[model samples]
Target chain A: MTSETTPKSLRTIPREKAFYFFTSIGNYTGLSASSLKDFLEKINQVNIKSLEFHLNRGDFEKWLNEVLEDKKLAEQLGRLQRSNLSGDILRSQLYEIVSRHYKELTTRAAFSM
Target chain B: MKLKNNTIALDATDYKILEALREDARQTYTDIGEQLGIAHSTVYDRIKRMEQYGIIKQYTTIVDAEKAGAKKITAIMTIYTEPKESEKVAEKLCKAPEILEVYTSLSEELQIIAKITAENQESLHTFIANSIAPLPGVLRIRTSILTKKFKENAFSIVSDPKKITFIKETRNIERRETV
Candidate 1:
């Protein structure tokens, strides 16, 4: 019998708040993982500056395709990827795309309060 | 005391005294003087001078958050705003009770990092959603929920003179090794 695997494309309303949706995205997109989760749960906290440092070095296109599974976003990011933009420019681009995605995901009828 | 031509200077002794007090703010001037091999009156004078020069802001206690019933939840938010509106955004963030600290970055993206705390997760979410997101000039916000707190160093001018020297030597060796 084959084990069932959940598709990463399927967007589900997180049981927690919208903030957690970003954290889950971070985990899925390889920004961070369970290794840091336990420490944060117990007593350690992640720094935003450090997260920015890691995201600046991460593969945005891969994150959009593999984790978010958004073809449109992946295509947009892919174009920017070829431009060879500086880290700051790339970050702003990614932020805009992700912000749009977040708005769409949260606006779904299921998530409406 | 004047060092050379009209330069007010802090000597090694002053630094040592400052270091001792940093380790224990409640440390008596007599004890600090004894440890640093200076007179109590000298310690008092140096502290007074430092205070006058605005080097020493205030002596305060660092309370344990967990023990104080204040460790509810914490998150780091990365905020984006209009480049010219960053100062206004930062000021607004500072006025919010949930926000503990705010930092502005000098980048094309009007980036601000805010540390927020709340009594519970739901309240924290409400505060962000109802309070922060609608604020004028806030373009986008990305939040990271802190899972652990590995270190939070107290504000100090210098940790230890010996350690600072050692760390410098270690960094020099590391640089040489890499090269």
Candidate 2:
């Protein structure tokens, strides 16, 4: 199988899972999406979401609320908050959200944290 | 001073105060008032209210990396460790100064993701290799650094969409499961 099709690569991370994953990555690395694309890409290639579960251990929800205070993105995310989605879609959306506002939503040192 | 968590209501002025702080935290209340066309006292009041409501947290200075002569290395450190020792390992990492941030990822296949900052790449490497890698319970570590500085700043996602959304809905994707 190609790298993309491997079990580790092909598995899907649902929205909730993706939320945890991206948030953890953010908290740990201080990296917003644009800065950490290479890192995400590497993790993506491996088809693993270990980064999502472990790093988001602090007061992340509150921090998320503060940092991602975009009413619009919050609204869009709210629509999916209770609604369940697949892991892959969620992962993509997480990356999209970060990539979209990466330049703006993060500090210079955020990713390297 | 007392620290109380005040969860209360907010208004347009409160939002404006937050917006100002987000842009430049060092702006004086007088400067803020000049920009907002309000009295400095009014700006102070609004800011206090926002802080009371937990809307505005702390103010900080934004440092320019190029001018500071600090090397910015952004990496995703994937760690491998035994299942039982996860918490212990994470705790140990929390104490390490060079290891600024650590995240336990959902992709359990990799134990942790870390971001490191140092005066130079050599210090960063030494920190990761000698300091981080040698820690007990750490099995393997892989790292990648920023090749080019793209952009670093925060933007309001609610107000802007055209600028924020890049990966469209059609991309094929995958998710790594926890081990």
Candidate 3:
């Protein structure tokens, strides 16, 4: 998947919201036999520079805990917690979200914080 | 992953069918239908779809490595190469049947990770020293022989998530706990 410079509403959302959104996309893509191993392989091969950015575990964890109380995002996150989605699927989903919301994402870096 | 093969989506029903096939690929459509409460024709359709989509790639028997006198070893090979030689090395590695799975990780230590299974240490040694080493851009090779298979196939764990918890417990369970 290729990255987009124009960001979407997804990029403006905090890490928790972005995680849940991408996680859902991962589920939809990986229902078959796709695993994280396959997804990571795809990401590593992708030509997108912004797509190559890796999120820190500490940041992910912090965002996860904060959003764990939000019922809606939590529900989506719970669906992803099942560990059914492939890593490649999640990567693709993030790539899609990033590309789709490139302009929005780029314009508002402060929104993410 | 490389887009060399086709991929298909699988539903819950399809997963059940896959579970049965994993244990016995020779199972009759009627038997699977009976167990799944579906008609024989439906079973056939599902299997056909799986084949067409590449979910059920090829059904083959699992030969016992020890019983067949085939000393098995599991080694994680890390290949380092420049961008120019990536395709060349990947193409060459794909031709070797011993290599089962390959993944490119997001780590500095390794770029491409390959899992290889061989008959004996000598054969495995030759495979690494000769077949893999000769690749155009191969810069390094790190291999670890599998002393024991704590957990092998991902198919089992993926098909049944319960296996994950079971494996975790089994790994921690003491031998004395059984008695």
Sort the predicted structures by TM-score, highest score first. Answer: 1, 3, 2
- For candidate 3, lDDT tens digit of each residue in B57-112? 89887777778976677666666655577667777788889998777665664356
Q: Best-fitting candidate, measured by DockQ?
A: 1
- Complex DockQ per candidate: 0.03, 0.02, 0.01
Model 3 fnat value: 0.00
Model 1, span B1-179: residue lDDT tens: 33457445665677787788788989899999999888999999989888887677789888778889776888888888778788988998899888999999867776889999887765775576556655556666777888888988666655466866786689899999999
Top model by TM-score, which number?
A: 1
lDDT score at residue B160, model 2, on the 0-100 scale: 29
Minimum summed lDDT over a 10-residue window in model 2 chain A is located at A26-35
RMSD to the true structure for each prediction, in A, is 16.7, 24.8, 24.2
The weakest ten consecutive residues by lDDT in model 1 chain A span A28-37
lDDT of the candidates, in the order given: 0.61, 0.51, 0.53
Model 3 chain B TM at: 0.71
Cα-lDDT of candidate 3: 0.53
Please list the residue runs of candidate 2 whose C-alpha ends up more than 4 Å from where it truly belongs after superposition: A1-113, B1-6, B9-12, B33-39, B50-55, B71-74, B80-84, B108-110, B119-122, B155-179
Candidate 3 C-alpha lDDT tens digits along A1-113: 12253222222343213321111101111111122222234444543321222231122223434532323333333444343344566556544433433344334544544
